[model samples]
Every structure is written in structure tokens, then in C-alpha cells.
Target: MLRTLYRALWWLAAPAAVTRLLLRSRQERGYREHIAERFGCTAGRPLDDHAPLIWVHAVSVGETRAAQPLIEALLQARPDARVLLTHMTPGGRATGEQIFGERVLRSYLPYDVPHAVRRFLRAWRPTLGLVMETEVWPTLIEECQRRGVPLVLTNARMSARSFRRASRFGAATREVFGGFSRVLAQSPADAERLLALGARNVTVLGNLKFDMNTPAEQVAQGHAWRAAFGARPVWVAASTREGEEEQVLQAFAALNVARALLILVPRHPQRFAEVAALVARHRLRCERRSSWAVDGAVAGTAEKLDEDVQVWLGDSMGELGAYYAAADIAFIGGSLLPFGGQNLIEACAVGVPVLIGPHVFNFTQATADAVAAGAVLQVQDAAELARTLQTLFSDKPQRTAMGAAAAAFAARHRGATARTVEVLLTLLP
Candidate 1:
């Protein structure tokens, strides 16, 4: 009865959802481009006759990137396997294009309505489905189950807040979660949460993000950026969310440190212009990476930013490594207001010390482990962030030691992708 009602509610909300998508398209035009795919109405490119399809649904950029190592492992293990990648966001689709090119099939996932999911499954007929992280759609799972297409939840996690919300539905939550053939969790604590939610087959497979190898060129670019900064103290506020940027700007304003340069990277591509406007509103001179010419110049060159440019807007996609490499300290955003925080593993992988806000329930275990490893520091608010940055700026030795610890912490967590791939192999047709 609950499941039926849920579907009914979703069906009733279809018009509103379409309107929402239309509204979002105004800011992000890519959302408007793939209209047919979202309803599972269009036929994608014809499938290969010799190879079987292995589907992976990564909701956005983060989960898509997290699934990278596992995706590569699947491809290497079975050269005959064709990948069907689906994403809810344009960023994920763009990242998929950049990484996998024309090798894999990419599409916008259908809305979690029954008919759309059925149409999607009917069209593609994926042999196995791997839903990255906690993107469980009840109708989609039900359809997959009914169709005998095995589905596995990979690198799964649940924050306390998310757990509470799921628990409210009682058996409905179980019905959805129990549909998964297996749940590979990031931590033991995550496994416990899944078990309590009535997931029968849950295993702690660590974090797939740890296995994501940083591109060497990206790291080198980071070194170049650091060199470009010369004697100035540099820090990065990476993957920052909506309200948090204001807090970050305010904190930087309070410090009034002339030599301290901030590389501010907003989480969403659509917000680049907005963030730039905010920087201007704060009366801070800033240069955008997107606006930078391809003929790269150094600190003393003609193309160099004026010393008055206080913040460097990291507006480009897929170059986070460069920002982290150029920083003395790193602040992982999305934590300041209550958005569950962005991934800190990338920062750690680049050997940068991290500072985050108190709300990191999404990365609960990783955050705790990092702090225990002496890799990350948690601050209460923006004022505290300013004060902490001030202290770290004055002490170079502490930053170096912390960076080393961060790298070590990231290194120790490797091998999850291998474990995850092994489980995936078992489900293949």
C-alpha cells in the first residue's frame, strides 16, 4: 500500500517536476538539451552484438568520479563489456564524456516514475546495474527487480540525518533497500546503518574515492600554480556550496591579509557568474580561471594577474588537483551550512591539509578518520575559519606535517575499487 501510494504521489508530482527541470534549465542549459532521455522515450545508439551491457548510475560529478576506478576495472577485466552510464546532472554527463569519451553509452537517467524506468529498461536492457552511493529510487529498483536485472549499491553511505529520514518510512525503506543484490559500504559504521535499514547483504568495502588516481599532468599544473604565486601564502576553499561562499568571503575579509591569496572553487558550474558577482560585491579583485588565456604566463609575465586580484576563481572543471597543489591549507566546503560536505579525499590525495565545518555527516567516518589521523581540522564557523587560517599561515611547519599526514591517510585507504570490482564480477551475466 505504501509503495503504491508513493508511486502515485510521484506520478501526481510529474508536472511540477517537469516545471522544476524547466526552471533549472534557465541557469543550466544542458538540462534542457536531453529532454527525451529523462522520460526514457528515445532510443540511444544501437548496442553492440558481441558485448553485454554493464550499467552504472552516478547521480552527479562526485559519485561519477568516485566510480571511476571501479569503471576502469570493469572495462579491463571484461573487454567485451559495454558500459551504460546514466547521470542526473549535466556535470556528471560532461565528466563522463571527458573521461570515457565515446567508449561508453551516456544518457540522462529517467525520472523515478514507473513508466519511464520501464521504458528505460526496455530500451537499454542493462545486464547489471550499479547505483553509486545512496541514490536509491524505489520504482527504479522495483522495475529492475521485476525484470531480473541485478542491482548493486556501490560505495554506499548514509548520514545520520538521511538515516532518520529513511527510518521514518519503516518497512518502505526496507522494501527499497532490500531490493539491492548487495550493498558495498564505505565504512563499518555505514554497514551498520544499512543493516539496521534492513539491507540483508551489506559489506564494508571501504571508499572507492581513495582508489581514484590523480592525473600527473593535473598535479604538475598545481605545482606550476604554486610557483606562480611565488612568496604569497595560498589556500583553497574547494567545492564550496551556495551559502558557504559568503561565509568564506567574510572570513577572508576579516583576516585582511594582503599576501594571502584564496583560490575559491564553487561546487556548481552554473554558479560561477554568481560567485564572481559576490566577489565583486565584497570589493575583492578576482581573476577567473575560465577567463584566463590558454597561453599560460607566469607571475612576472604580461598575462599575469595583478597583485590586487585577491581571489582566483577556479571556474574551470576537472582541475581541482591544481588548486589543491597550489594551496598551503585547504578548506573542504558544503559543511558550513548543513549540506553534508564535499569529498575531502581529493584534497588529501594531493597532499593538502584540510579544514572543514562541523557538519560532515555524509563523510562521517572519513572525516573522523582524517581528524584522528591528524590530517583535518574542524572549525565551528566562519570566524573560527579565519582565525584558524591566520594561525596556519603563520606556521609553515605545521602545514607541511599535516599535509604529509593527509597523504598518508589517503594512501592507507586504497584497494576499495578492487574489492568493489570483484563483487561486481559476480553479478555479471
Candidate 2:
């Protein structure tokens, strides 16, 4: 009865959804491309519905990247488990498609309406489902449970605010989480938070982000980057969140930005253009990596050749590994401002010293550990951040020592992929 009514509501709202999409079509052509690409609703061979698939859904590029190590593990562990990867955002879907390619079926998760969920389940007939991080779709969870599709929430975390909201409707939320077969969370605090949210049979599984295996290309690129500006000294303002790029620019100004190139990769790719515009507005020359084609392969040879270029805007998607290879000192963004810090694991994985600013509630444990290990330096403001960057530029030995500590910290946290795979395999018949 619930599913029946939910589908009806979806149908009624369909017109509005269509209209909104049409109005934004020009502005968001990639999204339209995504829907066309995903649904086969635009006239290609339809997505196969007969296979018994393993469905995994992630929110965006960040979560999807975090889930990559696990996805690779699952594919290796179960050769027979045909994967179905779904994402809510167009960019997420794009990243998913690029990463998994034809090995995984791609789709936009239907709106959380009951009929959509029912249609999705009935069509895919997945053997098991994995929702990464906090992708809790109550209706979808309930439907999967009712249909006997085993569900697991992996690498889960819940902020205090999210916990409080779930607690207020504890009974309802509990009912939702009860549908999950198990929850493998990132930390004890996360496990406790999920338990509070009525999530069932949760266990502490350290964050998979830390377990990421760096590609050899990344290592090679890092060496190349070091050859280019490694001695010249550079500090990367990586994964900067909105409003934080300007702050990074301000930091560059306090010292001598001319001497150091600020490599700012926006946490969200959509802001790539916006950040480029901001850099231009500040009257600074910028080089976009996505557009650059260098002569003779050299460390940032394509970009740094433009000596007037102040900000190297990493507008490209799916290239963090390469960018991390191209840095000396790194600042993980979303921390400088109030947006909760971006993950520091990737930077750490590359053996680059890390620096962060206030606000890292999302990664409470990892940040705390990084700070204590002397693997990552935490600063309070843009002024301090500038001074810190300047100091690192002047001090090579300290930078090298910090980089080693960062790599060690990253090494200690591996194996979450294997552990997660173990838990996932248990769900199989």
C-alpha cells in the first residue's frame, strides 16, 4: 500500500520535474547528457534487467572516489557479482561511469518515491545493495528489505546534527535503518551515532579513504612535479571549498604569490569555472590544467612555464592523483571555512605534508590523528596559513620529515578495503 501511494505521488510530480529540467537544459547540458546516457531512455540498447547485480550508490565525486578502493575490492572478490553503480548527481554519475566504465551498469537513482524504488528494484533484481557513507534513502531501504534484497551501509558516518535530527524521529528512522542487514562505520563515534539513529548491527570499520592504493602513475607524476618545482618550493591550496579560494589568494598575497604557484582544485568541479573567474577578477594570471597541453613532458611543464600564472586551477575531474603528485605542501580544503574539511587521506597517501584550517567535524578522528602524528599541520586563519606556507617553503628538511610522517600515517590506515569486502561477501547466499 505504501509503495502504491508513493508511485502515485511521483507520477503527479513528474510534470514539474520535467519542466524544471527543460528550463535548466542549456545551463546544465552535462546533466541532460547524463540522463540520456544513463536511462537508455534516450534510445540506446537498454540497461540489462535480467542480471543478478550488486548495486552500489554514492552521492558525488568525493564519496564516489572514496568508494573506489572498495569497488575494486568487491569486483576482485566476486567475479560473478555484476555491479550496478548509481549516483544522485550528474557529476557523480559521470565520475562513476568514468571509473567503472562498462564493467558496472550506470543509472540515476529514481526519485525516492515508492513506485520509483519499486520499479528500480523490480527492474534490476540486485542480489545485494551497498549504500556508501550516509546515503540513507528510507523508502528505498524499506522496499529493498521487503523484497528480501540484503542491504549494507559501508564506511558510514553521521554528524552530531544529523544524529540529533534522526533521534528526534527515532522510531521512524529506526524503522528505516532496521531494513539494513549491517552497517560498517568509520569510527566508534560513527558506530555509536548510527546506533543512535536506529541503524542495526553496526560495526566499527576504519575509513576506507585511508586505505586507498595510490596508482604508480601518481608516483611517477609526483617525481616529475618534484623535478619541476620540487626545489623551487610550492604549497598547494588543494580541494578548496567555496569562498576558501579567495582566502587562499589572500594568503598568497601576504607572502609572495609570484614565487609560489597556488594550485587550487575546487572540492566541487562545478565551481571550477567560478574559481577561474575569481582568480581572473583578482587580476592574477591563471593557467587551467584541463586546457593546458605542455611541450615536452616536464613537471608542471605545461603550467609553470607561464611564469605570470599565479593560480593553477585544477578544473579537470578524475585527476586528483595526478594533482597530488604535483604538489609540495598541501592544504586540504573545506576546513578553512565552515564547510567541514575535505578528506586528507589522498594527500597523505602521496607523502606530502598536509595543512588544514578550522572546521573538520566530518573527519573528526582522521583530522585528530593527523594532528597528533605531526603528519598534518592545522592553522587557524588565512594569515597563519600564509605564514605556514612561507615557512615550509624556507624549510626543506622539516617538509621532508613531515611528508614521511604523513605517508606513515596513511600506511597505518590501509586494509579497510579488505575488511569491507569480507563483510560484504557474508551477505551472499
Candidate 3:
């Protein structure tokens, strides 16, 4: 009865959900590919038949990125073990498929209704289930437990705000969380909170995100971008969200961004057109990143006073490493306008000078440590953000020094992947 009620609530959230979906449908066909996930794909045939599979759910791009090393580790350990990947968003699914390529089987997670959960489980019949981060589906966990499937939550975290809300439904959340055989959290803070929520066997395995190994190919590509941009002081607003872009654009306009590049990559690729409209509304001369070099941006020059603010609309997908590589300084977005901020660890791990806003609750543990390591600069608003960027632009020495500190912080925090894999191996049959 409780599961049924919770499922109803998910259905009720659909109107607001569908409304957003309709708004994002303006993208090209390639971007709209994940629409099949949310709608339905009727699990037709078993894609991997040789061995036992593990279903890992990563809802969006961030989670998908975090899950990469774990997925690779799994593949290494169990040559016969299959990965049946499912993502809530199309962008995530695309990224996973791109990263893993044909090495793993991928699909959309069925909706969380009992029927959908049953349908998903029956089709995959995975021997084990692992959810990255805070994806606690009551029905999914309960059903998996019923089937004797070992369940685990990897590199998990729950913010203080979320802990409070989940505490409200204390009984229910606790019962649902208890279904997990293991909960490997990013911090002791996260583990303690999960313990409060009735999750047993919780441990602090640290952040696997910190264990993010900068891909060599990505660095090589970044070097290529660095050559193309050629001494034009550059900064990237990587993973900017709806309201955050306007703030970044407005600040850039005020900061004489015409002289340098103010690149904006929306968190979701679906929002590319809507963001482009917002850019044009600001009257900035914008160009798609896909058409790089075609815009004929001359190197080693400054924007004239009368020139329009040349906003590089980063419409391309799955090349963030390229963006990070291209920028001398970086602002990790989602913090300024409040989505708890995107992970600065990505930019920091690459040793790029990093900046973020105050609302980095999502990465509270990691960001706090990064700040202590002098790996990040916190800007209160657009003004300070501009000043910070300006300072970094002029003070190349300081920026380079900060970048090294960030990389060291990243280096010191690796090994979580091995720890998590060890946990997974212990629980698996």
C-alpha cells in the first residue's frame, strides 16, 4: 500500500515533468534520441546472453560520469559480467554509450510503477543492482531485495537539506534505504546521515569523483583547443543551468567579455536552443562551438569597444574535457542560481583554475576540502566573479599555482574506485 502511494506521487509529478520535456523538444533528432527512454521501449530481447548482468542506474550526465571508473572496474573483474546501463535522461544515456561504447548493454530504466519495476527486473534479471548517488527507489529496492538481488549504493551522498526532507518520511525512507545491502558514501557525514535513515552496512569509501582520472585523450584534445584559441584569455562556465546562464552572460557583458571568450555549456543538451534564444535576447553575437574556427575569431586580439560581446554558445555535447582544456580559468556553475552547484572536481582534477558560488551543497564535502587545498575560489556574485576572472586572467602565475594545488588535491584523493570495487566484490556471489 505504501509503495503504491509513493508511486502515485511520482505520477503526479509528471505534469510538471512533461511540460519541461515539451519545452526541450526543439533540439535536433540526435539530441532527442533519449525520448524513447522516458516514453517506453518495450523490453524486446535480451542483448547480452552469455553471462549474469548488473543493472546500474545513473540518472543524468553527472552520475554517469561518476560511474565510469566503477563500470570499467566491473568489466575488468568479471569478463563475463555484463553491464545493463539505464539512465533517466537521454544525454546521460548518450554519454554512457559513448564512453563504454559497445562494451556494455544500455537501456532506459523503466518507470518506477510496480509494473514497470517488475517489467525491468524480469527483462534484465540482473544478479546484482548498484545505484550511483541518491537514487533510492522504494519499489525498486524492495523488489530487488525480494528477489535476493544484492543491492548497493556507490559513492553515495545526501545533503543536509535532503536529509531533513527524507527525515520527514522517516519511517518510509528508512525502510526503503534498509533494502540496500551496502551503502558506500562519499564522506563520514554522508554515512552518518544514511545510518539515521535506516541504511545498514554503510561505510565511507570517499568520493569516487575525486578518483576521476583525467583522460589523456581529453587532455590531447584540450591542447588542440588551446592552440586554436591561441593566447585569447579564455574562461568556461561549464554545466550552467537555466537562470545561471543569464547571470553569467550579464556579468560577462558588464566585464567586457567581447575581448575574451565566455563559454557557456548548459547542463542538459536539450536546452541548447532555449539558451541560444536567451543569448540573442541579451544581444550578444553568439556562435555554436561545433562551428569552431568557422567564426574566424582572430587570435591574440582584444574586443573593440564597439564590438558585440562574442558569446561562444557551447552547443556541443560530451566534450567537457575539451572545454576545461581550452579554458585558463573555470567557473563551476549550478551554484550561483542554486542547483547545489555542479562538481568543481572535474575542473580541479584537470588542474584548471576553479571558481564556484556559495551554494555547493551537493558537493559540500569535496568542495570544503578543495577550498582548504587552495584548489577553488568562491565568488559571492557577478561582480566578484568578474573580478576573480579578471585577476586570474592578469595573474597567470597565481592561476597556474592554484591549478597545481587543485591537481594535487585531486591526486591525493584517488583510490576510492579500488575501495568501492572491493566492497562490490565482497557482496557479489
Tens digits of per-residue lDDT, candidate 3, 166-234, equal 998867888989999999999999999999999999999889887667677667666665665555777
Evaluated against the true structure, the overall lDDT of model 1 is 0.88
Q: In model 3, which runs have C-alpha deviations exceeding 4 angstroms?
A: 10-23, 28-50, 256-258, 293-309
Q: Which runs in model 2 stand beyond 4 Å of their true positions?
A: 1-28, 34-51, 225-231, 256-258, 295-304
Per-candidate Cα lDDT values, in order, are 0.88, 0.79, 0.80
lDDT at residue 305 of model 3 (Cα atoms): 19
> For this target, which candidate reaches the highest TM-score against the unseen true structure?
1
Candidate 2 displacement at residue 304 in angstroms: 5.8
CA shift at 218, candidate 3, in angstroms? 2.1
- Candidate 1's error at 370, in angstroms? 0.3
lDDT of candidate 2 over 1-429, digit per residue (tens): 544565677678766776766666554565554543232232222476444578888878888888888888888888877888878777788888887888877777777766567777766778899999888877788888899999999899887767887787656778777779999999999998888777888999899998776677656665565455434556677778888988988988897534677778887766778899999988988888777663324445533345566677887777777677778889989998988788898988888999999888788889999988889999999999989888888788999999999999999988888888988888876
How many Å off is the CA of 393 in candidate 2? 1.9
Residue 276 displacement (Å), model 3: 2.4
Candidate 3 has what TM-score? Answer: 0.90
Q: Which parts of model 1 are misplaced by more than 4 Å?
A: 45-50, 294-302
> In model 2, what is the error at residue 333, expressed in angstroms?
1.3
